[model samples]
Target: MAKKDDRGREGEERAARYLEERGYRVWDRNWRCPQGEIDIVADDGRDLVMVEVKTRRTDRFGHPFSAVDRRKRERLWRLAHAWMRAHPGAARGRSVRIDLIGITGERPATAVLEHLEDLR
Candidate 1:
């Protein structure tokens, strides 16, 4: 695989570990269904979170989270709706939240992680 692709996978893994450690139950990674890919799907018991993970090796370009723009938010919203519809019980009366996981570094140990909740 390409170096950038590998870096992204590593970032996602780190984010997953961090979320799990915080008592969040991860439902899926790279969950896709025509709408788009949700890097991570998790539940913090009270709500369902659709996570968009932006991983970068450096911040020279910009902060990783900056990559998730308005268009991306729209797609995430659609995907979240589809997910809830398919698993109605999972999201019954529960709020839905969009999150951004910003990761920067070439390796997990050197990475910086930032979690932006309720992005939508």
Candidate 2:
């Protein structure tokens, strides 16, 4: 894989571990459908969280979370519903939440990370 791709994966791994450490039960990683891929799918309490992880070596352009614009967030919601539908009862009556996890720095383990919940 390209260095950037590898770094991105590393960031995702870090994010997944971070979420798990915070008491979130991770259901899936890199979940995909026709719409697109969800970096992580984890549950907190009764809500299903669809995570979008953005990683960069630095915040030269902007914060990693800044990459997820409003349009991208909307797309994430669509993908989240698609995943829920495919899983049948997994999301029955439960709320679906969109989350963004941004990791900055080459070493994701020690990188600065931020988590934003409930985009919409």
* Prediction RMSDs, each to the true structure: 1.0, 0.9
The residue ranges of model 1 lying beyond 4 angstroms of the native Cα positions read none
**Candidate 2: segments with Cα more than 4 A from true spot:** none
The worst-scoring run of ten residues by lDDT in candidate 2 lies at 65-74
The per-prediction tally of clashing pairs is 0, 0
The sequence of per-residue lDDT tens digits that candidate 1 reaches over residues 1-120 is: 898888888888888888899999999898889777888999988889988888887899999988888988898899999988878888988889999989887675468899999996
- Candidate 2's TM-score reads 0.96
TM-score of each: 0.95, 0.96
